[model samples]
Target: MYPHPHALEAVAVLRVAELLREAERERRLPRTSLRRRLAYWLRAWAEKLEAPNSQLGYA
Candidate 1:
């Protein structure tokens, strides 16, 4: 089965967040751009997933 665009985007955002958190833990400066981009992607993904009377499942 083909994956949805929003699902792919959500995965990308989660990966970025994991990288940023690791960088922060290592005392390295986390890139602001990455954080901002993650936020935007997550917001868009959430909007797509959250629909009236619809149940969404994530893998």
Candidate 2:
């Protein structure tokens, strides 16, 4: 069944509000180390590539 148009609008507004709050939280967080940043990128890459856990290496 389809949702009411107003409900979809409300959901979009809520999501935008949550995203704004998340951005604010990120701005307040401490700077990450180079190694930590590298690990994060590696993890994201592995996920995107659908690589196996064994191939993730030192990350």
Candidate 3:
């Protein structure tokens, strides 16, 4: 069965978010920058899901 496009995008976004958060916690990313990057990625992912043909690229 084919998965819903939005569901797939959501899973992808969540997985990325988890990885980003982990990296941040591990000190791989700067604390102040982490928040900005996370918010950017999350918003881009949501936009991509809502607009399948949009040209936004994932991080």
Candidate 4:
């Protein structure tokens, strides 16, 4: 069977988040900025979506 659509979306989001982290590690992102804050929240949301017990109500 194919993977769930939501699962695929979550993986894509998580990959983008990982790239943001790599940019930060390379001193590309600002230490205290809106972009960094948004990235942080995006990563958190992706993690929640990727959780086994996600509350998104997917069957």
Candidate 5:
């Protein structure tokens, strides 16, 4: 069964918060290159997701 809209949004917010926590952990790592790569990939993904003009039906 499909989730309710509020449930879906809650899950999304939780996931984003978890990702932010993971990012913060990565930032604390001593491997600068790895952190940079992670940031780069996250940025690339955000850009790719944001640049899509097609309606994703989320809103």
Candidate 6:
């Protein structure tokens, strides 16, 4: 049996959040620019959410 299309979504979201947080924690992403970086993440996430996925989770 295969996993569902939405199954990996949470993982993706978590990973993105964690990576961004880690970047910020390491001071790689400036505090002043955090909002822009987060906005980019949100757009990417929205794109993934709105994409039409096949059963295999491909576009």
Q: In model 6, how large is the Cα lDDT of residue 21? A: 69
Candidate 2 per-residue C-alpha lDDT over 13-52 given as tens digits, one digit per residue, 9 for 90 to 100: 4454455446546875445686457545544544433434
| Cα error of candidate 4 at position 15, Å | 0.3
Give the per-residue lDDT of model 6 (tens digit) for 1-59: 98776768745765776687678679897666766778478657745754787343534
Query: How does model 6 fare in lDDT?
Result: 0.66
Q: For model 1, how does the per-residue alpha-carbon lDDT over 2-56 read when each residue is reduced to its tens digit? A: 9876677666656765665666679686558976687567656555555454344
TM-score of 3: 0.54
Sort by lDDT, top down from the best: 4, 3, 6, 1, 5, 2
* lDDT, candidate 3, 36-57, per-residue tens: 7776788667657557564543
Cand. 5 TM to true fold? 0.42
Q: List where candidate 2 sits over 4 angstroms from the true fold.
A: 28-59
Candidate 4 global lDDT: 0.78
lDDT of 6 at 45: 71
TM-score of every prediction relative to native:
0.52, 0.43, 0.54, 0.64, 0.42, 0.50
Q: What is the per-residue lDDT of model 4 for residues 1-59, given as tens digits with 9 covering 90 to 100?
A: 99777767777777888888898899987777888787989888777876778886332
**Clash count for each candidate, listed in order shown:** 0, 0, 0, 0, 0, 0
- Candidate RMSDs in Å, in order, are 4.8, 12.9, 6.8, 3.4, 5.9, 6.6
Better of 3 and 6 by lDDT: 3
Q: Write the per-residue lDDT of candidate 5 for residues 1-59, one digit (tens) a residue.
A: 88766556545554654575586778754557875676666555444444546143322
Worst 10 residues of 2 by lDDT: 50-59
**The candidate that achieves the highest lDDT relative to the unseen native structure:** 4
**Is 3 or 6 the stronger prediction by TM-score?**
3
Which has the better TM-score: candidate 2, or candidate 6? 6
